[model samples]
Target chain A: MTQQDRAHATREAILHAAAQEFDRLGYERTSLTAVLARAGLTKGAFYFHFPSKEAVADALVERQTELWAQVRESWRLRGVDPLSALHGMFAESADRMAADVVLRAGVRLNADREVGYPGVPSTHLMWEKLVATYVIEAAERGDLRPGVDPEAVARTLCSAALGSRLISSATTECADFPSRIREVLGHVLPCITAPAWELSGSQSASEPA
Target chain B: MTQQDRAHATREAILHAAAQEFDRLGYERTSLTAVLARAGLTKGAFYFHFPSKEAVADALVERQTELWAQVRESWRLRGVDPLSALHGMFAESADRMAADVVLRAGVRLNADREVGYPGVPSTHLMWEKLVATYVIEAAERGDLRPGVDPEAVARTLCSAALGSRLISSATTECADFPSRIREVLGHVLPCITAPAWELSGSQSASEPA
Candidate 1:
C-alpha cells in the first residue's frame, strides 16, 4: 500500500477506536492514552492526526451527520411516496440504533447537553428541515391532507421520529422495535393526511389540488 | 430535633448535591468525591446515605416516578373531565419541566437513553404503564373512541408526549411549547376518542364527556 493509504487507514483506526471507547466509557473518563492504547498507536501518532479529544468528538459527529444526510438523500432520490419514505427513514434509523455503536453514541450525545459534541444540535435541525421539505412537497402534490401546515406537521413528525430513535436506543432487547416504529408511523400519518377521513374526501379535501 | 430528622436532613443533602452534580456533568462523569464535596461530607457520610452511583440514580428515578403519579392523581381528583384532565396533565408536565432540574434530567434520560443515567429503559416502561393507565380509564368512561385499543393508544400517546418532551428539551426559546403540546394532543385525542367518531355528530361537539 502507498503511504497515503496507510495514513488514511490509521486515521480511520483512531476514529473507530475513539468512538468505541467513548461510547463504552463516555467522553470525560475516556483519556487520550486509552484511545492510543486501543488504536495500538503512540500518543505522538495520535497528536499527529487530531489535536484534542473534542476534535475527535467533532469528527465523529460530522461523520454521523453525513451518514444520516446520505441516507435521507438516497431515499429522496428514489422518489418514494412521502409517507412510505418517512417510514423507511425511521425504520432505517431504528435499525441503526439496533446495530451501530458510533451512531448510538451520537444519539446519546443528542440526549445530554452536558456532553457537548459539535454539530449535534445542527444535525437535529437539519433532520427536521429535511422532513419538513418532503412533507411540503407531498402536500403540494396532493399526497398530504388538505389545509394542514406542512411545516407544523413536519415538526410533529420529526418529533415522533426522534422520539422513536430514543426509544430504540434505550433498550437492548427491543427486538420488535423497528416494526413497532413503523406501526406507530402508520397511526400518526393519518392525522396529517388531508381530509382527515376518507383520507381524501373529508372536509379539507375540497381544497384545490 | 429527632434522630430521624438528622438522618433525613443528611439524606436530602446528599440527594441535592448529587442532583446538582449529575445535572452539571451527567451520571457517568460526576464522581462520588465531587458529590461528597458538594454535600460538604466525607466519603463515609456519602456512603451512609447511598451505596453507589447507580443507587443514587435509582433513588432519583423512584422519587420522580412517585411525584408524577401524585401529579396525575391530583388532576383526576380535581374533577377535570377526561379530555381537559389530559390537557392539563401535559401542561402541568411542561410547567414542571420548566421549573425543575431533576425532572429535566429525567426527561433527558427518557429521550436519549445513552446519556444521563443508564436506567432509561425502565423509565420508558414506567411511562408506558403510566400513560396506559390513563388511556384505559378514559376509555372506560366513554371518553376514548370505540375501536381504539387502550394499550396501543397508550403507547402512541406516550410516544407523542415524549416527542413533545424532546422538542421542549432541545429548545430554550420556544415559549409556546406548552400550547404546541396541547395542540398535538388535541389532534391525537380525536383519533382515539370514544365510540370512535360517529359520522353525523362528529362536527359539532368538542370531544364528549
Candidate 2:
C-alpha cells in the first residue's frame, strides 16, 4: 500500500475508536488513553492524526452534518417537491441514527455544551435551518395552509423531532424512534397542509411514500 | 424557634445550595465540596441533611414532580375541561421553570441518566402519563378530532415541549421558551381539536385563554 493510503487508514481507525468511546462514556468522561487503546495505536500515531480529543469530537459533528446533507441532496435529486422530500430525508436520518456509532456520538457530544467544544457549529441549528428551507420551499409551492408562517412551522417540526428522539431513547432504548417521528409528522402535517394539497393527499406523510 | 423548624430550615438551605451547583456544573462535573462551600455549611451539617449528591438529585427530582402535581391540581380545581386545563398547566409550568433554580436543576439532573439515580421514577414518563390522561378525558368529552389517538397527541405535545426548551436554551438563554412551546401547540392543536370545537374556538390555544 502507498504511504498515504496507510496514513488514511490510521486516521480512520483512530476516529472510529474515539467515536465508540464517546458514544459509550459521553464527551466529558471519555479519555484519550482509552481511545488510543481501543484503536491499538501508539500515542505518537494517534497524535499524528488528531491534535486532541475535542478535535476528534468536532470532526464527528462535521461528519454527522455531512450525513444530513447527503440525505437532503439524495431526496432533492429524486425530483420530489420540498414537502415530499422531508419524509424521505427524516426516514434516512432515523435509519442512520439507529445504526451509526459516529452519528450517535456526534449527537451526544453536540448536545453536551458542558464539554466546551465550540470548534464546530451547533448541529441542531444546522438541522433546523435545513428543515426551515424545506418549509419555505413547500410554502412557495402552495403546499402549506394559507396564513401559516414557514419559519414557525419549521421550528415546530424540528423541536418535535428532537423531542421524539429523547423520549424514545429514554423509554425504549430508541427502538421506536422512527414511529415517534412519524407520529409527530402525522399530527402536525394535517394542520399545515393546504386545503388543495389536503384534498390531493392520498396518504399521510408519516406513512411510507 | 423550635428544633423541628430549625432542622427544616437547614435542609432547605442545603438543597438550595446543591441545586445552584448542579445548575452551574451539571451532574458529572459538580463536586460535593463546591455545594458545601456554596451553602457555607460544615461537613457535619452537610452529611446531616443529605447522604450524597445522588440522593440530593433524587430529592430534586421528587420536588420537581411535586411542582407538576401542584399545577395539575390548580387547573383541575378551576373546573375547566381537560383540553383547556392543559393550557393552564403548561403556562404555570413554564413560569415556574423560568423562575425556579430548583426546577431547572431537577430537569438537568433527570435528563442525565449517567448518574444512576433510579431511586426516583422517570419524571418525563410521569409528565407524559399526566398529559395522556388529559387527552383521554378530552376524547371522551368530544373535544378531540375523530379517529385521533389520545395517547399519541399527548406524547407528541410532551416531546415538543422538551425540544422547545432545548432549542430556546441553546440559542436565547431560554428567554423564548414560552413562545416556542406556544408555537408547538399552535401548529399541533388545530390538528387535534375536533372540527365542532374548531368553530367554537375564538382564540388560538397558543394564546392566553
Candidate 3:
C-alpha cells in the first residue's frame, strides 16, 4: 500500500481503539498508555497521531461529523424530495442506533461543552436546510398538501430522528427500533403530505382527555 | 413536628445533599466525607441513614421515581382525557427539563449500564408500565388512532422522552426544547390513536425510495 494509505489506516485504527476504550472505560478512567497498549502501537506513534486525550476526542467528533455529512450527501444524490429524504434519514439513524449504542451515546456526550467541538455554522444549519429544500421541491412537484409549512415539517422530522437515536442508546433491545422509526415517519409524513385527507377518522376515543 | 416526620425530613435532607454532590463532582470524584460535610451531619448519623455511596444513589433514584409516580397521580386527578393527560405528561417533562436539568442528568447517567445503578430496572420498569397503561387508556379512549400498538407506542414515547431529557442536559438553553418535545410528540402520538395522521408535509419533490 502507498505510505499515505498506510498512514490513513493506522490513524483510523487508533481512533477505533480509542472509541472502544473510551466507551468501555469512560473519559476520566481511560489513559493514553492504555489506549496505546490496546492499539498495539508505541508511545511515540500515539503521540505523533494524537497530542492528548482531548485531541483524540476532537478527532473523533470530526470523524463523526464527516460521516454524517456523507450520509446527508447520499440522500441528496438519491432524491431531491423532502419527505422521502427525511424518512431515509430517520431509518439510517435507527439502523446506526441498533448497531452501535455506544456511538449514539458518544455523539450525545461529545456534542456538549466538555468535548468542545463547536462545529461549523453551516453544518449546524444543514439538517433544517436540507429538509426544507426537499420539502420545497416536493411542494413544487405537487407531492405535499396545500399550505403545509416546509420549515415546520423539516424541524419536526429532524427532531424525531434525533430524539429516537438518543432514546435507542438506553434501550436494551434493538428489535423494534426500525419499526419505531417507521411508526414516527408514518404519523409525521401523513401530517405534512397531501394524502392525509384520505385517512378517515376511524380511530376511537382511547386516551382520557 | 412529630419525631417520625423529623426523622423523615433529615433523611430527605441527606439524600438531597448527596444528589447535589454527585451531580456537581460526578460519581468518582465525590466522597462520603464530602457528602456528610455538605449535609451537616456526623459520619455516624450518615452511616445510620446509609451504609455506602451506592445506597445514597439508590435513595436518590427512588426519590426521583416517587416524584414521577406523584406526577402520574396528579395527572389522574386533573380528570383530563387520556390523550390530553399524555400531552400533559410530555409538557411536564419539558418543563422539568428546564426546572431540574441536574436531576434529569443524574437519572439519565445512572441509567447507563456503564455508570451502574442496580435499582434502575425495577424503578424504570415501573415508570414504563405506568406510561404503557396511559397509552393503552388513550387508545381505548379514542385519543390515539386504531391499529397502532399501545405497547410499541408507549416504549417509543418513553424512549423519546428520555432522549429529550438527555439532550436538554447538554445545554443551558430551553428556548427550543419545549417546541422540540412537542414536535416529536406530535408525530408519535398519532400512531397510538385511531386513524393515525401526521400534521403536515414538506413542500419538495418526493425523493427516490
How far out, in Å, is residue A120 in model 2?
Answer: 10
Q: Which portion of correct inter-chain contacts appears in model 2?
A: 0.47
Q: After superposition, how far is residue B167 of candidate 2 from its true place, in Å?
A: 2.0
DockQ computed for model 1 against the true two-chain complex using alpha carbons = 0.26
Name the docking class for model 2. acceptable
Tell me which residue pairs clash in candidate 2. Answer: none
- Deviating ranges (above 4 Å) for candidate 3: A1-8, A23-26, A29-45, A96-109, A112-159, A172-179, A196-209, B1-56, B77-81, B100-130, B137-143, B173-180, B195-209
10 residues in a row with least lDDT, candidate 1 chain B? B200-209
Docking class of 3: incorrect
DockQ: the better of candidates 1 and 3: 1
Off by over 4 Å in 2: A1-14, A32-51, A114-126, A198-209, B1-14, B32-48, B114-123, B198-209
| Pick by TM-score: 2 or 3, better one | 2
> lDDT by residue for model 2 over B1-209, one digit each (tens)?
89999899888888889888776667777888998898889989888988888999899988987876776677778787787778666655665666667886787677666222323355567768889998999899999988999888888898888787666655654557767777787798899988766422222334433
**How do the candidates score on chain B by TM-score?**
0.67, 0.81, 0.67
Regions of candidate 1 where Cα sits further than 4 Å from its true position = A1-7, A24-26, A33-45, A107-123, A173-177, A195-209, B1-66, B78-87, B99-121, B136-152, B192-209
Error of 1 at A71 (Å): 2.2
